[model samples]
Target: MTTNILFCGDASMTDGVLIATLSLMKQTRHPLHIFILTATLTVNGHHYRPFAAGTAERMTKLMQTQNSAHQLTRIDITDLFVADLPRANMKTMFTPYCMLRLFSDLVPELPDRVLYLDTDVVCRRPFDTFYNQSMAGVDIAGVLDHYGKWWFHHRLAWFDYLNSGVLLMSLAHIREDGLLVRCRQLVRHRWLFMPDQSALNIKAKFKRILPRKYNEQHQLKPDTVFQHFTTFFRFWPYFRIVTVKPWQIQAVHQQLGLHEYDDLLKDYRQLAPKLKEVS
Candidate 1:
């Protein structure tokens, strides 16, 4: 059978997500198809092609010397969505809010449903239980907000904070519906941080299916294998500017190795070698 899993990340991002994803492909019990949706260039001019695709292939190759990327498929955004990514997202591009919007736009016209993942996630165990569940009755399976209602609606709803880390949903509902259109309108209106999220929260209002250990945003237990790195940038030096706490990233980085953090720091021009190169 065909199970569609969606992930969004760029080349400049740390190789941790890349490693996590590859490892998951190796462990998944199904046919293990992966669809990566990422643009070729960053708004800053960094190239995503050689690094993202090349590393993915290298990792996959290393995992199974006899295997190809069959268990893994990459949806090159460079081949599809170019930088014309709506002009309104100028300020919020990397925010959690923007990731949701970009992910919504990347849904392809496919027969199978999609399990959208943030690049920061890794599967510690076979997630067949979560994957095979019925999403037909709900828009997605995600976390219920313990913090409070969607930040935008908190003043009005007084509910939980519904985080959008990992989601299993159908493309049909997003495409042939009013959600995507509303996202476009909100972006055009310059609503900023919550454009796509606003639409998603509104559409799936009170309908999120809290999966069993599926949306675990924190550390995983002994039985838990699939881990979604929800806190990659919480401690980001830019945290003061962005204001969101980074979580679960330090631990995940241990298995991914130094090269990942090495490059990520370089991407930010915070590394000495990278700085010397630029100078």
Candidate 2:
């Protein structure tokens, strides 16, 4: 009865996914069945070996200490019927991976419910509490979007918009309510900064809204279970504003004031320091 966690990404986001997973593993002792939806592997198998062997070994050690274990599963995109999913031509960072999450119900051998996370998030505390909790009556549970006021649809107050980065989805409710079909319909007609995210928000907008602890974005708050890297640029402690990614070398030389997040990414750096170093 291991907890199931899902992530969707291609080569461009593999490392981010790896780091995010390691961060979660670091905080929790509960066994996890990590499901990754990806199509192509990195150019060489090189990027994957270290994460599979080295980082996985670390997880094994931690799990052993806690009397738990974990497994990794990769679901190929080509195996799914996603060839015709509607995608907006907006120049956002949207990718095919974004659309794969909509087909959560189609995932073979999946559990009744699962947690979905974006590659940019880092888990700070144990979430098996929320993961194992019942959704009550909602099909999906998520935190309210901090930037919801900027979204055109959210301004209408149709429903409280939520950031799609972290979601606790109840497959039973989704299938029962025809959520997939509705989400597909919304995706086909609407264009948002994040198409898939916007579609999910529009469809599940009235569902249960989780506490702020579940998905803290950009700003770190007390009792935060998840810390998200929504903003890449910041001017703090430094005289001038600068952009820095913890995964990038700039973090070490520039005073981006993000060292607070070092613990979240330590395993990632030690195991695979370079971009695409882990797939």
Candidate that scores best on lDDT: 2
Angstrom error at residue 115, model 1: 1.0
lDDT of 2 by residue, 1-279 (tens): 577888877655656777777777777777877777665322223331112334344444443554446776666654453454454523345554577777777766667788888887888888888898877567888887776735535445454778888988888788778777688777766766677777787676347778888888756777999876665434455555443444664563464455656665666666555334243
lDDT of each: 0.51, 0.67
TM-score of 2: 0.78
What does candidate 1's lDDT look like per residue over 78-180, in tens digits? 5333433445664565532244334454445433477776656555667777777765646556765423243445335455445665777655655555455
Tell me how candidate 1 scores on lDDT.
0.51
For model 2, the superposed segments whose C-alpha errors exceed 4 Å read 40-68, 79-81, 87-93, 150-159, 232-246, 252-255, 273-279
Clashing pairs in 2: none
- The superposed Cα distance between candidate 1 and the true structure at residue 75, in angstroms, equals 2.6
24, model 2: CA deviation in Å? 1.0
User: Please, what is the TM-score per model?
Assistant: 0.66, 0.78
